[model samples]
Target: MLKMAKKHNMCFALIKLSQTHKQQLPAWLHCGALLRTYHKLKDACLKQIHEVKSIKDLLKVSNRPTTVPHHWESHDCICGLCVSDRLAGCKNPHKCISTVAVIINNLTPKFNPFYCPINDGLTLTHCRLEKNTRARTQHRGDIIFDPSVSETLQLAECFRIFAGDTRTAQAPAHRLQRPNQGQGQQEPPIEIYTDSSCINNGKNNAQCGSGIWFGENNPLNKAIRITGKTQSNQAGEVAAILIGL
Candidate 1:
């Protein structure tokens, strides 16, 4: 499909629309060669070398009987990952591990890299992406590939929800109806109040949340816990507005 897209002058959006049901094109097509490379590393290297069965395992920090080794001393570790980290001159091998996990778990919007075992290993790339600045932006779930079909589907569904796709039952009504259209009655104005909150505002451990109040007991009401790069009240406010819209 990607070959056909390039061969004929097809817009990328059209390709995405084609795979909206199947979920084949979006992430796979977006990642392409990088996807292949990561999978190859997982299958041919990480699995064989470190016995990684899941993203959780893959992101696990290297724990020796002694304290974690410095980059220069990584050559003495048991795993090839450490040796490679040393060769790459990485000051912290856990950061490298976190990076790989983030790439693979691409579909999760609430992915707190810190939630992983290696909480202190967030890479500079993760930090930059979190800012959501025009200078560096990425569509969160557009570059994931997983061997498990069920897991992939779950991730895709999560991405769709976080991205405000409203096809699912959990979302509010898909289309709002005008009151008394046949009688030419104008639709009444519906008011919605939105707000955001954050704990430990400037700290790394800060948690942000947003709320949408349509009415008491209204199905449209939502309480959202924000995650990822923009873990701030401002971001939560923006998210609340977008979701409400």
Candidate 2:
């Protein structure tokens, strides 16, 4: 009983001191065993933190579908997503809403696109294409992503509901809506075949490169450099296709 009480007090003390100016780290830092435990949980915490961050990244992308006629005139329907329900269900409503707002407002053309498999369609680049064209990249899942304009307002809703801010909270339900085929016409996609290869497999230093093959006699053929940290055969192959795209 005494040992349990001591442990409880130690945790409470750590919490209180963690917020201090940080001239000194919490004493727990000195405990290698404790750090090992923290390392074990690091992946789970990173996963959750990344999911929340993805909501913020969504704001940096454009919501307009470039292929749609008069895309500039069309209002993003994703913006209509209601957050009142999410707020009502949140235990820390104020923090959640505020964090979400910040994340959702970051959409822009300069943003780098990424995928979060755990997130809804509102955050996916595939969903940002013309409604009918979304199918072309549907199977790519979170692997292939690019910044786009389409259903951006919905991103705000997603951020508002998912951001925990400084507190821990469960996010409400959300999902990417199916592309609603609008009357607008779509631009044709350019087609090409991409491939990659690497030499010297698990050796001291390997050479890897990506390549794009357009057609039997097409002149747009070339090899791409993908050498940095990834000297593996698969990384080279994947890099080739991504570069081609």
Candidate 3:
């Protein structure tokens, strides 16, 4: 509707201006005179939508060529050249400069990978371990020790030492010293570590074992023989902790 109103006004102004000025204009100037009058009417219509800052801008807007219809094209519209002219000047010079400065400051610096900051000469390049050294040996020959004799000796010593030490039997001190308890008397908290193994995981004889380390020196240590279930050392360790919990 706005475009139609602009065209109608332009046509009316051209007719009126030509009738008034025809006597003073030459015959060859008819087209040029009408075109100038049409542009003046178009400029007046544009003034209602946008601000004109200077005489130069007003004259440029008022002297732009009129668009002629093309029959080969399905629609008639002016190109964007005149519309871009309306927005050409920067209204805020300071804001434009600040925006450009921010853009320049954000760019990342380029560096060679061989001389990159993290890889620049301060890092060690090799391991320090001796390549062919052998570990020390523990015993020259195997002499099997009697497991029951050692156990009996250990148990006898424990009994002798604890016989005079009444603290282990004292319920109040026992409960107070219990690692897990906060107050009063209670059983000590126990932590267990376990492991298991199998000859074959899918369908063969399997074995599992678990060991308990109780108290500071791992005293009262015990291990259980397990079979028929397959698992790794890590899985056994987890199972031990779970059972202890």
Per-prediction TM-score: 0.27, 0.25, 0.19
Best by TM-score: 1
Candidate that would win on lDDT: 1
Supply the global lDDT for candidate 1: 0.48
Candidate 3, residues 43-84, lDDT tens digits: the string is 332344334433233333333333322211111223354333
- By lDDT, the better pick of 1 and 3 is 1
Q: Which candidate, 1 or 3, has the higher TM-score?
A: 1
State each model's CA lDDT, in order.
Answer: 0.48, 0.39, 0.33
Quote the positional error of residue 244 for candidate 1 in Å: 1.2
Tens-digit lDDT track for model 2 on 1-245?
43653444322111111111121222112211112323323223222432323322222222323332332322222222213323333223233333433333332211212221244434444445544354465754334353322223322232232223234221222344547646775656888888777789767688888889887777788778785776888988788777777
Q: Per the 3 Å backbone cut-off, how many clashing residue pairs does candidate 3 have?
A: 2
Cα distance off (Å), candidate 3, residue 205: 2.4
**What 10-residue stretch in candidate 2 is worst by lDDT?**
12-21
The deviation in Å at residue 37 for candidate 3 is 99
**Error in Å for residue 56 of model 2:** 36
